[model samples]
Target chain A: MDRNFPQELLETIQKADRAGAQAVIDAWAVGRPFHRVIPELLSPTLETFGRLWASGKDGVSLAEGYVAAKVAEDVLSRVLLDASGDGTPRPSSKGPVLVGNVEDDFHPLGRKMVAAFLRADGWEVHDLGVDVGPAQFVDRAEETGARVIGASAMMFTTAKNVAKLREEIDRRGLGNRVQLAVGGAVFKLRPELVAAFGGDGTAASALEASALFARLARRASEARGEVPA
Target chain B: MNSLERVLAALQNRSSDRPALLLNAGLYGARLTGAALKDHYRDPEVFAEGQIAVREAFQPDLLVSPFALAGLGAAFGSRLSESSRRPPNVAAFAADSAEAALRLPLPDVDSHPQVGYLRDSIRILAKRYAGEVPVIGLLASPLDLPPLIIGLEAWFDALLFQPETARALLDHLTPFFVALGRAMLHDGATALALTANLANRSILPAPVVERLGRPSLEQALAEIPGPVILHHGGCPLLPHLADFKGLPNTVGYVVDAGEDLAAARAALGPGPLLLGNLPGPTLGDLSPEDIGALCDRALSRRAADLQFILATCGADIPLDTPADRLEAIADRVHRAGRVEA
Candidate 1:
């Protein structure tokens, strides 16, 4: 679908009017499917919000991006509930995905957005929050039988920790069983860092995280000679 | 000229024999001075000892306190943690919401233990240097304090959703910074450095910085004494350069490595000292010879500017930076000074 984000909704979000923004999204969703709204309207709005936020332009604040993401998350949860009422199996019944910020990094908004997107895409997501160590990630993955682990680092200093986490994951012999994905502002700044840190995959934004996780899952299944579920 | 004279001359926009080097030499100096980072941060005496060793090693123009933002946040009841390698940081935020953050008790700058420790550290450093070298007291700016007081994400949220609450929190915290600046000055600090890590395009949009950050900083700057330097490692200060220049007491701007130095110089004019543009990330990776070459390049680029000071953009020198590489940069600057003489 050719999705044009409503400028009015974007303005409402920028104004910090969460209720008005939600009302606008709800109105738009009256005739549209939740899938269409998420990928087309919501995702594009978030991308635009980020761009404007970073542009240091008028009427944009880091807080507006936070508010927009929160509103989108609420809408996503509601959409998922509504979709589940139609007597269809939830899309995320495939396997659990664990997401978190790497050690020594307190920035978790990226990881939280990735988790929300994955949950919206019908995957069971386990969010480990920010400043998470390698052992915690591995321990949670083992307990939940997570098929994919997503790690994020916001700075070059903390991005170095992702490499350590990757080593710990390999040392534990979970390298093949669990796909390790890494991203954040640092990843975008240094594109080669994904491979440098021994990550299975990387995505530029939370919007692309679901697809990246799916591709990694497919590759993991192929490596195991198992039919793609 | 002595190290102090060289730095003051550069700041005065006069022709010093060479560019003044304001090396951070804080964290790396701790390791070199035989003071563990953990010990240096915990005890004022160890911090003073580390600062003295760093001054002896580099003989740089400025002597910044070994401690950074840990004391300010801790004074306000935020939890702090120390590690062997890294500088201490807020272990946990004091509050989650703007109301709760504003409700945090204002620290008694005179008697607060952390503030007292910082004051003692400054006093010892000043006495040891005996006014030969200038000591800088560091304080986080209003915009930067939110993240330390509350969490980063929540603070950003407050900036967007509840700006009034955010402003009130800053208003409440502004006195503490002013008091800290006054006390440090009384304790013999020659100047104060305010670190505004959040006032950048990467963290907040420019309008928000103008609306929220500028006023709080102006209020604090109005009360603090002159010769205050503004430090923000986030590049692209071009947008907020005007805001900084408008501050009454600001005498210099520290441009991070990736920022446009020419743009900053153009905006700031020749009056305010422009220090830095050195990349901190490559400090550990580059060889001593490479570091000297880098210094030569930076000096040659701004040969005509009389107000430039060679310095690192970041507050803390990277832990792994080789002592020889740092010495090389200082050696290059000193050699340049000798040639000019």
Candidate 2:
């Protein structure tokens, strides 16, 4: 949450100096344990990037957002891998989450970006991959106990299949147990469909997806009467 | 005035009683023919028949040829699936990688059915209309074709991380688009609806697009030899209007619904026609009243811009979109009445 951290990182990302951005992160993490670096600095910095991207006033393009996320992803992943004193990398405690292009929707760009951003924020992302069915999304979330499901579809037609995820969730009475986040080109182009598609929420950009999942998780926690982390 | 004359009036920014209606009722047209959407996509006769059927019902100013960008992909050897209700998604790629794509030969539009379907539809409609209406054919620009051929993720990966490789792919794909676009024009297309999403700011930064995407586009547009309308490709165009103005043969842009029309018109400087932006993909879900509100708002906003065409924007119109919803838009454009000179 330090003010000085994000501005420097933002400048590096804006200039598209990936190595410089990594160097900035490394400087911040030099004294701090790398694992704590995410919750303390990296996550908040990503939030700043998300706001800048969503604002569009400062002129952050998707390519920049993708680059920033890629940098964040590379940093967070390496730290998470090295966090354990043991060689094996333990998953982030941010909780389980699933992402996929909804059944019959094979466009992978949006979904891939979402995975990167979530992984950057230390969310344990189970990429359901493309051409995923509705039952499979819910069943995997059930099997994995993932608190959030990000369903992506590029076209309005393929996006319609996302509704089946809502149906599967409700049919299994997992509404309060898990949250559905609908997105992709369709929702971006036709935003009114977020609620129409039964999404608990939708992020404006991939960098924002992690925060959306957190909010959804908190809501699900409240519904289930669990203490918020 | 005939539909063509009205469209010409809009294109000329001439004083007119109304804004020309350029509804892209392509996928929606398949329903009118009583054939499956996939069937209509393949059979030029059925496809043109559907466009004709909709033309009878709606009386749009611009007659749309098959707007499926996938048809161009199919010409390169991609096969699509899950196209029953909507436009088919390319299930298989023409070439899975930039290397393989480079090795793939350019399709002869005259021989390839995928590309020929486009030319055939334009040929059929232009003959049927015979100067009564203008047939606008959809053509994917050179920079946009990598996503169609190699896959969206792979292409974007190469574009973002492997710049030289992406430029090489663009160099290879540029002539194919030029050839098909020129062929479509020669076959009787009044204009080409060129999908140039790569040029839009939302998709890529201006510097990146200007440096990487624009050169190929300028090259392709120079050779097409016909009027070109830059499509939003489901992205906003207002920010890039001034830049797009210089592309040869580009006379209009299909604006996104979310953009400020006044700003777009100002950016375009009254020279280029603006055709768009009813949210087409959600047409089936919106009520008639919602459709009217959107139409009424778009009409009022651009009511003064003489070079304005009222039409749908963002992805294909859902096939199941109620006919009445389209008629609702059509009726509004028709009843929009005279714009002040």
Candidate 3:
């Protein structure tokens, strides 16, 4: 609960170090951004805890895992506020990107984490939340003039919607207009599966995806002979 | 001993030395191992080969669907993307509307492309070994449908915040699900695995699960007219188990590892057969020798009861669960002094 803790929370989260980040998380767990912190920081941290429990450690318990996740969620919700509004201006020339879960998938923890990371990197991101249909994605992309679209789904059942988006893009003749990136638990198991839906690329992790989308958007501009903005 | 006798004896609460295998032939195996379905539709030989492999390997007493729960939702209108590894996924729900819900009619098992594939797979399995192994069809509990329609967040919000709308949507969706179950039963599924994750404690609030899920499940259970086998993952559904017990044709209940079997026995009380609560991480990831040792611990700790059937709490079998390890779990179960052969 040190005042200096949250300043390092994002950095600590990036390192994926649970012990290094726990004090910050425990301090911010009940403060705000619980969902965001849980998956981004707490869940991954507890993932280590889970491994320990599985390996016959006697001290750790599921309750500890739950507490860690809840606290992380709180910090996530709190830190998420004013991030976009208070965001430092876009220092990069790449176009803005929109990310979200498709209409059927409800798991937003992953998507929110990605958004937080992107916001910190100075990309104005519109997170459409979970379960937006194909039309919603197209409408949001066009409205925002977004050159890159990112979608996340944890279940294989919902991951199929990525292909539907591709079909929608082709129907609208926007194939050349935007690049699509897909990620999530399903994609983690099979990165190649994203191509079945015709995405430009797939990210297996938050960092890889944020970097991939920026590069893809820049490349899309270059293909048009525009200087890489 | 054959699987049927082993399973039947176990169900009867008699002691048995012959192990009873009950492996699922779903995408979990294909997902974990990166194996393909070989054929998703109209290939009897492909279906036969996969079934034969499982039959020879596990010699399981009961055969459950090899596909994921999202298959039915996908066949109608959901975007189902398959992977070489992991189960097929739906990117999102159709939308939160009665019209959207109705637009995706329950794909008739005999006609829908994926359902046709499953049915063909079943026919092949049955034809190849009818009396030897009973085939159980997996159906999503109606509570699961609302989430697919409105999205999980919206559905949860509806359950917690807007009770009336949730009730209305559930009222409409429940019967169609029952009809699907009846169709599968007619297609030769001796047992039905009803997965109501939305109703499970992992996701749904206990009171909401009781209020929204219990009634529809009760109706579906009555309509399906077969032994219903209920499953949940992550969170225990002890509060909802009473509702399952109250259903008319309920023959068995599967308590996940999230649940305490001793508590489940106390809740359901000795009539319906209890299957599962085998944690996959514990059972599937260890070596045969290590797993066998853990299996001994698991049996001694729980499942050493008259009414327990052997099964995983949920199906996410690790890729490393060797055929021999699979056999060892069964062998250990058979060797349990209380288990009947």
lDDT of 1 at B312: 76
Q: Against the true structure, what is each candidate's TM-score?
A: 0.90, 0.91, 0.61
Cα RMSD for candidate 2?
3.0
Model 2, A139-191: lDDT tens digits are 89989989899999988788888788899999999997899998886787568
Candidate 3: residue B182 Cα off by (Å): 1.5
Superposed model 2: Cα runs more than 4 Å off: A1-6, A19-37, A80-91, A188-192, A221-229, B15-17, B95-100, B300-304, B339-341
Assess each prediction's global lDDT (C-alpha) against the native: 0.75, 0.82, 0.62
Which CAPRI quality tier does the interface of model 1 achieve? acceptable
Better of 2 and 3 by lDDT: 2
Clashes of each: 2, 0, 46
DockQ of each: 0.38, 0.51, 0.05
Superior by lDDT: candidate 1 or candidate 3: 1
- The reply for model 3, stretches above 4 Å from the true place, is A1-229, B15-19, B28-35, B38-45, B96-99, B238-243, B281-284, B301-304, B318-321, B334-341
Best by lDDT: 2
- Model 1 chain B: weakest 10-residue lDDT segment is B332-341
Model 2, docking class: medium
